[model samples]
Target: MKAVVVNEGGALSIQNIEMPKITSPDQILVKVAYCGLCGSDIPRIFHHGAHFYPITLGHEFSGTVVDTGHGVTEFDNGDLICCVPLLPCFKCDECQKHYYSLCKNYTFVGSRIAGGFAEYIVLDKKNAFKLPKGISPLEGAFFEPMTVGMHALLLADGCEGKNVVIVGGGTIGLLAMQCAKAMGAKSVAVIDINQQRLDLAKKLGADAVYHSQKLSSEAIHQALSSSRFDQVVLETAGSPVTVNLSIEIAGPRAKIALVGTLHHDITLPEKTFGLILRKELQILGSWMNYSAPWPGKEWQLVSQYFIDGKIKLDELIAGMGDFDSFIKQVTALNGRPMNGKILLNCM
Candidate 1:
């Protein structure tokens, strides 16, 4: 089998590696179909952020089951599935409490072990989720990011009948906007530095879009006809600026979910810090997408929404190609402004 391997010092190559086989009774061997490139992949591939060298980095992927071990009863050959990349130790205290995402000992697929950037891979039965009939392999590949947005919403206690503000227009941010609308938010507003993403947000049903570069925080409030968002504010940009903006624009007692991965230190201004006390805000720190019963409701809901046509993914795909094209795309990541998801067809 051929797999894309990231060697030490950030060099990538497509090499022939031995095919992974099912070694556990609760495992399944899958033929890779599609894999979505995540924003985090950029750092791991180019910035030496990987846990180890010679890694195959891809977590958001979908595939077809070719064989299942005897212990796997829920899935069989020919099943279309999307993977839950977290491999949690079921014996840990966090795992005992059904907090799989917070498990003290956890290994991720793309980061800690072999991932789905190849022709085939093996997955534990617990990590493989079957896709519904209407969802395509490309759409199935989106399940991971879609679940991420849904996980943030769940942490904020959902968005129904509330004014929601998402402070990013990347794939996760845009998906959160659509999920908010699908869950019956009164209004959904998206803020971003990128005009292309803002436009894409509007096309996907955002009630309003704001270019962060052009609008002052005051102006954004005025445009929305509100002093601040009263219900929910999701900070998904993972930047210091957007983090503070989420604090600035949140109304009293608003449930604010921090969904993005922060790479820099953030020191809140005195006024910003004071708002938390004065407004009695609910600050929720969202982690990876997982809950009780293994992969949890986030995955189930995302799969159902995709089947029901409540979410749109085609517009979020900025590029798609095979392995050679994937190599070129990876090379182009430096100094490039990526506004959408890039996909690789592994088979």
Candidate 2:
């Protein structure tokens, strides 16, 4: 089997490796199809960010099942499925409470163990989700990211009939915008410094798009014809500026879900910090998408909405090709901004 392996920090190569086999009764072997490149993959590839060297790095992927272990009754050979990357320790207190994301011990596929950047991989039956009928492998690869936005929405108690503001126009931010609309938000507004992302957001159903570089937070709020978003505000950019803006634009008693992974320590301004107290805001910190019943409703809703044609995945794909093309694309992204998801056809 051919796999892309990062032998050490800042080093990557495509090497023929032994194929993973089903070692447990509750496992399945999947022939890799498409794997989506993530923002986190950038640092793991270019910097010393990976948990270990000589590891295959890809998690958002979909494929066809070639074999299923005897204990796997829900799935069988020829099933099209997407990988749920989070491997939670089922014995932990958090896992017992159905808070899989908050499990004290967790092993992520791409980060902690062998991942899907290869011709084939083995997965635990519980971590493999069958794709709905008519869902392509490429579309199935998007399930992970879609669930990310949905998870935040779920944490905020959903977006139906509410004015929703998503502060970021990146992949996750854009997906969050579409998720809000699909969930019956009265209006969806997106804020971003990138014009291309903002334009794509509009095309994907954002009622209003604001360029954060050109407009002040107050100006953006007024442009939306609202003093502040009283319903929901999702901060998905993970930037300090966007984080502060999320705080400033949230109305009283609003549900603010912090969905992005912040890389730096954020020192909120006195006034910005005061808003949390003054507005009596409900700050919801959402982690990876997982809840009761394992892998939860986020993944289920993403599959349903995608199959129903309510969610868009094609427009969100900025690039797609094989491992060689993926390498070139990664090399070329030298401080360049990525507008959408980049996919690698592993098979």
Candidate 3:
């Protein structure tokens, strides 16, 4: 098996490694075909180490089952599948209450353990979800990201006929923009510092797009004819600027969902901090997708949206490359932002 491993000092290498195998009767071995480069993978590779060094790093993926353990009845040797990356201890308090994302005892694929960066990875049947008929390996690989966008919307609650603003045009941001529209937002706007990404957001269904370099938060009011969102989604959490910006743009009593990962502390300026109290805003923090309903019900809805042509990724797939080339793509992309998804052709 070949995998891209993170060794000491966060260095990455595409090396041939031992093949992962099923240790329990409920496990299944998937021959990874395609794996998408998630935003989270960049930091783990180049900065803070998640688990021990020498671990694989990829979670957004889909593959075919090459082998199944004796107890795996729902999946066969040839089944195409996507998986939930979180490996939760089912006996934990959170897991028992159907809150797997909040489970205190958990190991995440691509972080705490070997992930889809390898040729083959083993998973329990509990984490695997069969892809729908005709779902391509590339599309199946994106199921995780789609679920992420869905969960963010779920956290924000209603979107029907209300103005919404997404404060980042990355994968999660773009997906949230489309999901907001699909769920019936009267109009949606996407804000990002990158012009190319904001342009892609417009193409994807955002009614308005703002490049932070060209448009100030107040400038958005003019773009949308003095409109303010009933809800605001802050998806660019890594930046303190965007976190404060989310607070600046939210409407009175509007809810804000913090879906982005904020690696650093966010210190709100006096006026910005005052917005929450002045507007009576509701700030909701959301984490990973769930599996209480069995590998997550949001996965099912996202798959169906793809099937019905309401959602598509043809424009978002920037390129696909082999293992070594895949490493370069992600390495370069971390510094230079692009409009859509990039994948490693693990096969």
- Each candidate's TM vs. the true structure? 0.97, 0.96, 0.93
Query: On residues 71-108, what C-alpha lDDT tens digit does candidate 3 reach at each position?
Result: 88999988899878988888988898878889899888
Best by lDDT: 1
Model 1 C-alpha lDDT versus the unseen true structure: 0.87
Clashing pairs in 3: none
- Cα lDDT tens digits, model 2, 243-266, are 899888778788889988887899
C-alpha local distance difference test of each model = 0.87, 0.86, 0.79
Candidate 2 residue spans exceeding 4 A from truth: 225-229, 335-337
Per-candidate alpha-carbon RMSD to the true structure: 1.4, 1.5, 2.0
lDDT, candidate 1, 1-347, per-residue tens:
98999876667899998999999999999999999888888888877888989899898999999999989999979999998999899898889998898998988888888899999999988778898898899888988988888998988888888899999999999988988888889999999988988888889999889998999876775676662555799999999999888877777788889999998999999998898888789999999899877789898888778777899888888888999898888778763436688888976
Candidate 1 regions exceeding 4 Å error are 225-230, 335-337
User: What is candidate 2's local distance difference test score?
Assistant: 0.86
* lDDT (Cα) of model 3: 0.79
Against the true structure, candidate 3 reaches a TM-score of: 0.93
How far off is residue 305 in model 2, in Å? 0.6
